[model samples]
Target: MGVTDEVLTEEHKIEIRRYFYNHQNADGGWGLHIEGHSVMFCTVLTYVSLRLLGESSADGDGAMRNARSWIIDRGGATFIPSWGKFWLSVLGVYEWDGNNPLLPELWLLPYILPIHPGHWNSARDQCAKEDLYFPHTRVHEILSSSLHNVVEPLLKKWPLSKLRDRALTMVMDHIHHEDTSTHYLCLGPLNKVLNMICCWVENPNSKAVKCHLARIKDYLWVAEDGMKMKGYNGTQLWDTAFSVQAIVASNLPNEYGRS
Candidate 1:
């Protein structure tokens, strides 16, 4: 869990944006976890976060599109890192062909199973018990921004009834920070896809943002392969492993370093 604030004032957002611009690695990079190699999640997400804070992606502020290209070239959200793949797969952006076949079989296991997050988080109360009562971990509050009231419900980002009117609104605002600017429409689903739709719909500008959505929707066909992606990149490891495995499985072997 990284820093989770109820709200980041515009001034604070600007200051943080300045920090990312000034403190980014001298190599014109930022690594995963502030220590590891640069990754799609760190590069794209952080760079976008900076931009949302009002940093420019152009040459004058910093070439954030360079980072976006890193993610795009490697493949966008689909090819980010291991966790990225898992989530992308879960979110239906990637196929499970290369995954290690997570033993959700464990869900069927007897109570004695040892490797569960349930077992690992010894310091915390039983997740099952806690969830039974509380059911979710999201921290939300009353919001005053236009994002919470206007954008959230329009996009249908979360279970609206479950959320306070304020919380649902907040979700749209956060997603809007990136979606409104990035021209990204990766996570396709009835509701999430609506966010992209709304961005274009709501853009009162030159109608340019609407075109971005039009382009993304160009590859929206479904199939028996079960909505397989054209070439979405979920996690860095997920994409790399998938490519490597396909090559090896084809019996045309080659040496590639596996992270």
Candidate 2:
């Protein structure tokens, strides 16, 4: 894991490409999950991912072209959800100003505060219609509007701006603590990736980034379809328990052990 060479081999690339192609929806787009309906969020993300993997827009038997068409027909990548916008911004495809500020300063507030950013709330209700399962309430809209229009500007002022820097330092401290405690695996794949991004942003050549890079393979798994990112680092204990229960319930393990 300490090796400095590229981790993903050509074979790994081929398998990952196969995994994307294997799970492509009939409409030539992708979904948030393997079995989900094609939505702008996942479709755009998948299309960009394949492009990053060196697939031409005309590749995939025109699957990439169809994906572009699907996105255009649904008002382009602008219709993608907030998470999509964030990643696209990170990838340099979308402008950072387009995204609602996910203030790290929120983390400095008391945990008991009801207005914490961790609450299940959308800062902007502009997701694609397909991904908009829950519409924003009037109260939510008002609060978000106030935050964006009033509170955000005030926070940028001289006195409060000082707090922003302090808040960011505290946020990075928490991220470092989480990474060290989890041995660089973090809580889940999403957080793991986010923490790695944070670590790289803080210092690209730092040991924290190296450790995170070393653990990238922990989330990858291969199946009949191809290589895919697993939902968690590992579930070996859970899988073992489930398998043993199933075998015991069938009485096959007991009967077959003698053979």
Candidate 3:
């Protein structure tokens, strides 16, 4: 039977999503499959995912609470990098200002604006980035006008609101699917907010919003470190590794030699 059939409860969704989030490294992101080192790839997408589910930046959890600070550091959503800016844009939260200078009038200027390498950093890094987690942006198209290697797919015709709607939808679907897949242990607080965001973004006045909002009760998690992502996950491997390295520097590695 599917996991959906076995435990499929709201509580379970909370669990898995939290795993993905707490396991996420700093920068407010998650690793791919929850096994890799953290990168902005997981951070930006997961941040939005959690918010949409039902968890708010105001959540008592450290990971969930620090989201906006992460986003605004690049300048209140105005100065986030291209892909980072896109995620914010897709959520309908980013401002049109500070966007790469997209002169629609250039289309009428009769000369295609040449995309110069001078403005971008590490195109390889940009290309390697996982678009699925980031979502597509119109700002990218405005600058390049070519999709030769765009990280994420562009919404048909590049309609801002439509693309925004779709991005919002994907996160919501993820929350439902996450809950169904994990029996509602909670897909981490991020997914909780992701579920909340989906309903709010798509149909703010619908029952889904109310339901997600109410589900907030299940998302609260308490920890010795002043409330954090629930069941944050295994740290023995990482912590032990650090401890060993520290002992080695102190010439204590020989102590284990006797064993």
Candidate 4:
């Protein structure tokens, strides 16, 4: 529903549109959660999602116009966080240069190295890449000088080139391994969408793309009001365990003792 090409069903699109329309705030924006204040991150993504799902920008009530004004007032999409930049890039709504580099090859570092993922205390630390922009320089210029930019131009300049093929192959293999290990769910909704885009860009016909499309259904949740994308697959197991503990703590087990 959110600009996913050929991967979303008609039912999904209808439900997603219903969810967005139902949740739009009085100010014509959205928030990070149902009860939260409107934020640029949530507002922009939801607005784009609705547009992609066939909603008109020129609707009579000025819903889309109001959301656009909100985004512009908040310094626009470029000011959105890294994850927002990533999704917008995939959707072709934002330039990839706006984002800090996210190199999958970072995982290829030797395990004994101090910078290896296993050596980091937090997952965030393990994935942190350089923030390459300076206050004076333009983002495009900074990105043009990046290693990815340098190598990408060379690859484009020479088709079928073998220069970085070996290293690039290793990175691609690691991506595939991750897709398999996580069953295409990845770490969360953002990561899942990014990985799907990566797989599609790399090889639309690859098994990885198929796996991602097949498993995406797990992240959707339907409710009486409407439907929405979930942070992850259902939390039934976690909720059930917590419920059992809470019940025990309430001393309700004695009142409802097993026969």
Best by TM-score: 2
Writing each residue's lDDT as its tens digit, candidate 2 over 112-229 gives 7987767544435668889888988899989988998788898889899998889889999999999999999988899999999999999999999999988989888888998988
Better of 1 and 2 by TM-score: 2
lDDT of 1 by residue, 95-203 (tens): 8774666667676666576755355434433456645765534442223234556765665655654556576568657767655454554443343456655655556
Evaluate model 3: give its TM-score: 0.32
Error of 4 at 8 (Å): 3.4
Each candidate structure's TM-score, on Cα atoms with residue i matched to residue i, is 0.33, 0.52, 0.32, 0.47
User: Relative to the true structure, how large is the alpha-carbon lDDT of every model?
Assistant: 0.55, 0.87, 0.58, 0.77
Worst 10 residues of 3 by lDDT: 224-233
Write the candidate numbers in order of decreasing lDDT. Answer: 2, 4, 3, 1
Which 10 consecutive positions of candidate 4 have the poorest summed lDDT? 120-129
> How would you encode candidate 3's per-residue C-alpha lDDT over 90-169 as one tens digit per residue?
66778656467665565555343464324343353354345557645778645554444452455444565587677767
Candidate 3 Cα errors over 4 Å, as ranges: 1-16, 26-28, 31-41, 58-61, 66-79, 109-259
The weakest ten consecutive residues by lDDT in model 1 span 224-233
TM-score for predicted model 4 compared with the true structure:
0.47
